[model samples]
Target: MSKQNFVIGLTFVIGLIVGGLAIAVWPAPPLSTPAGHALSLRVPKNRQLLDIAISPDHSLLAYTAITDGRTRLFLRPLNRFEATEVTGSIGAAQPFFSPDGTSIGFFSNGFLKTTSLYSDGATPITICAVPGTPAGAAWRADGLIVFAGPGATGLREVAATGGTPVMLTTIDQDAGETSHGWPSIINDRFLLFTVGKHGYDPRLTLLDLETKDTRPLLLADGGGFVVTPSTLVFARRGELFAHHLNSKTLKATTPKNPF
Candidate 1:
């Protein structure tokens, strides 16, 4: 071969070998573990525990415990497996965490109250005066709390710093939406709740917070919890079920069979 052609051939062969070695030595991307680990939670023995809430960071668990014939709030670190009672409160329930996870908002007696995870006292934010009891609550990132209002009136919201709550949405009697309750925020702009005349007829409804418009999302509902931006878990007739949802467009897909 000519001297020039031989040199070019040798360089091309060397370049092919280097490229092969680089491909073989490069690391593959890490895979995420989709399986869950089993951890048995030790619930309170005598107290009827209800309305459990986990923190945004998944480090803390809060729930309502009916002990000594009075409802109270309890919190426990998930790593420790022990529960601590929240003091300076008179009957509390339906606990939800703030965006930062440093504080919790709950319904106490007839008012909405907020208490820090590291503090010993709770401060009332507004007089909900919910007859019978409050059904559900959700806290927003912008320091506003949406909760169930008195006597199936509708949903109400108040500043986290304490103020009079303004009505957010009310049931349309003409449409047969007799009452509204059990609210859960699907996103910053939309809320998921139940609206019906009776317990057996509760239906899942979506509310647009920005425009104050409401619509039905599911025909049956007990309580709806947002598992992800595109998924929701709801309870009905003592059974749990889930559905795929498009939060951006306020649309829900076919629900899976209840488990």
Candidate 2:
């Protein structure tokens, strides 16, 4: 098959595998009761959903979909059925919401950008140029954004509005480290990220924003998130695992357990 045909076929197979998934929001407590509901996402015919992110406040959901060979971001309010296209978000991917939920940060055309959700026709404001595809990013509470840039090691940070990005961690090549990405900020002083190496499982690592110290929490296949102050959730082989964390000390208090 031709290269274009091969790409299309691959996308179709991926869509078939992932399209049936739905977003389920479980309510706090009442584990025996069915207080949660699934959000059935609607994608345009022939388009495939690329990524999805919920707003910090849980009021809106932003996702990227491939339409007519281009990818763009779409905003869907939790209470509404229709999803609205985000203006100037063409080529967007791996979107993350700002702390206030009034704006979104995304990667588009080798640049890290942000756009306001409340604006009538807001254009994306470029923050910095990234050489390769970013693994993931997080918006910090202190008007800064941390991201795993396309590089061999370490992470970078840039101002929320727009500015030059600076390296946030040192390269640990002696440990056979290849890349660092999938940053999840856990308050102003702590962060969670994935440390990757060739031919090995990715390590879920923690970083001290103040001291620049890092420690591996566990082996994971993908990035992780700080679901709660004391709960760190990560993915491995299509299954989710949770680690009990001491939020104040930034340490893993228990072994990895299935979530």
Report the lDDT tens digits of candidate 2 across residue range 34-132. Answer: 344456667779678777787776678788889989999999887787898888999998888998989999999899999998788868789998877
Prediction 1 TM-score vs. true: 0.79
Where's the lowest-lDDT run of ten residues in candidate 2? 13-22
Q: Which stretches of model 1 miss by more than 4 angstroms?
A: 1-35, 120-131, 198-200
Pick out the ten consecutive residues of candidate 1 with the lowest summed lDDT: 13-22
> Runs in model 2 with CA error above 4 Å?
1-34, 253-259
Model 1: per-residue lDDT, tens digit, 77-151? 766778888875558877778978998888877777887776645544443455566767888878888888757
- Predictions: Cα RMSD each: 19.2, 5.5
Model 2 residue 44 CA deviation in Å? 2.4
Global lDDT of each candidate: 0.68, 0.76
Error of 1 at 175 (Å): 1.9
How much is 125 displaced in model 1, in angstroms?
5.9
